[model samples]
Target: MSDHKQNPLSREMKTHAMILGSFVAIFWVTELLDMSIFRGRLDRFGIIPHSLVGLRGILFAPFLHGNLAHLIGNTIPFVVLGWLVMLQETSDFWIVTFLTMIIGGFGVWFFGAPGSVHIGASILIFGYLGFLLLRGYFQRNFASICLSVIVGVLYGGLVFGVLPGRPGISWQGHLFGFLGGVVAAKLITNEKRFYS
Candidate 1:
């Protein structure tokens, strides 16, 4: 009995870890390639607004980064918040990630400067932050609400990132990523019932 119960729980833990780890690995490997072999040429794949060729960046930009500092800055928040989002349900991770990419990516593609190239995982970071912060309110569950409070307390500073004041910063990505989270929370969590 004990072994059987532990098996499922252990499997879940492994799956959760694997999923988050894969995302991190992709980011790191892509950055490594861009820095070493590609010579930063991969950055051109990032979002460029209003150009047909640039539209592909919406799919690729989240994996590319401006430099090591940018990738490092995004890595922690991306993993931490992503794992937290997964805690609700493993599937929630995929839903949130897809929505964040599509919504957040397209938002940048639409609103970003014509000549500018936006590259970084900050879009997903802000997406995870936004989903975590708003999910509780939309779901109206005690645990989710508590999680939101904790997330807010710890990462509330991320709100400032959505503003457009910083140079070379893609505030549009941050803002849209956050909004994507909101959209995910509203669409996914509202129907979920925590209590019988």
Candidate 2:
């Protein structure tokens, strides 16, 4: 009985896992439906640069991928970096996600090449990377600093994705998503400072 006593850390980890798992499941299910029934038509919902109708893609784009390979490429990083963001505070995950979607989507819509449709979870993945990289500096704490170091060593190579050279890749999305993550880390740390 005592062994089963509520453990806040354990409960929190479970909650984080459930949330992340649900998001990954949604991504997979949406892709399956898009490929099987929609015949990839749903991809039209992805961000179309400078089109009014495309504005809606800000909310939908992350869930839409070009193919299995694209989704598979995004899955591991999304899970790993997303879990890192949740370690400090679960609510931070939602805040960072919301900001990244809005900022990164708009950046692509405004600056991406004409007729291009930006889709995939890479935007959010970059956002997570940026947030993890900067959270330590903003928070100025030992644990956050250590976490930042670990993340930097692990994903430092991904920083190059923000550059505009990769064919068919949305570098604009990566840049803006990274910016959004920086903004989120700053905002969250400031809020904590104010509250404390």
Candidate 3:
């Protein structure tokens, strides 16, 4: 009889995979519901600059998308980058995600153009990008540096999204989400150093 004991790292990876999968599922499900039952009206839940009512969008915006194409655009990068963020420590995923949501969402609310509503998972996607790109520099460790290099090589082009070039894209979301990721990396690395 062959034994089938799973290793700790394998278990951790599975857990991380499930978490990422569930989030992606939610994104798809929400979009489906909005398109079919809600008639795209759910998009109004997205951040509206300078409106107290819009403050709630910070919590809902990431789950809402402008369209099927928009959601599809965000799904792949979200899975890839999100997996990378979890590789070092699964908890880092939660921390980075939380920080990015709060910081990125608030940035949109405060500085976004008036009369515009921002919605999509791109904010979180950009946050993951920022974290991975800078985690190496902040941690200053061999493994982290290697991971950062790999990520930069693969996703460096995404940095241009932060600039104000696209007509309908939310550059503010990208910029602030990225900054939020940088902040998350700094805080996490600092905490590790302090503890170690």
Candidate 4:
């Protein structure tokens, strides 16, 4: 009953270009607004220590940010890593991103150091990076592995980004995002031998 032959490319499948472009544009817009006057309230709705007790910040934390620097920093990796995931597997890319956000967000709230409130896209960044790393290994694509290592190196500084006392920062969120990426990468995709 279904005509796979006649399905419009746009309707049937999303391309890497579309996925990457959308993330770039959306992040740009979000960053611009973050630089605007509403900057002070970034964490107002972000995942807070108290949020876990209430179980409300899981969905909202990933969307919140502390400042332009924070938003832009996370966006760069997100666009790159998200593009990789989008390019590799279309079916579960969005699902993976969403899952990373929820799980990462909740993880931070629950496990982060006490009195620490979290914000920003660190979870998504790490999630994308994590998937790309594992998927690359499973696929045994030399190019993919190299790319992942490069990204890993670039974002390695993120570990420090998760620490406190930096002023207007939410390092805990970064930690959660990183952990979320690893967990999701291992759980979502089946571990397999090198394909090529």
For model 3, which pairs clash? none
TM-score of each: 0.94, 0.96, 0.96, 0.69
TM-score, prediction 3 = 0.96
| Cα lDDT tens digits for candidate 3, 52-142 | 9999989899999999999999999999999999998999999999999899999999999998999999999999999999999999999
Off by over 4 Å in 3: 1-5
Global CA lDDT computed for model 4: 0.64
User: Between 1 and 3, whose TM-score is larger?
Assistant: 3
Error of 1 at 109 (Å): 1.0
Candidate 2 global lDDT: 0.94
Query: Which residue pairs come into collision in candidate 1?
Result: none
RMSD per candidate (Å) reads: 1.9, 1.4, 1.8, 4.8
**Please, what is the whole-model Cα lDDT of each candidate in the order they appear?**
0.91, 0.94, 0.94, 0.64
lDDT, residue 57, candidate 1: 88
Compared with the true structure, what per-residue lDDT tens digits does model 4 show for residues 2-81? 55556645543456567766766765565567668566654566666654443456765666666667677777677767
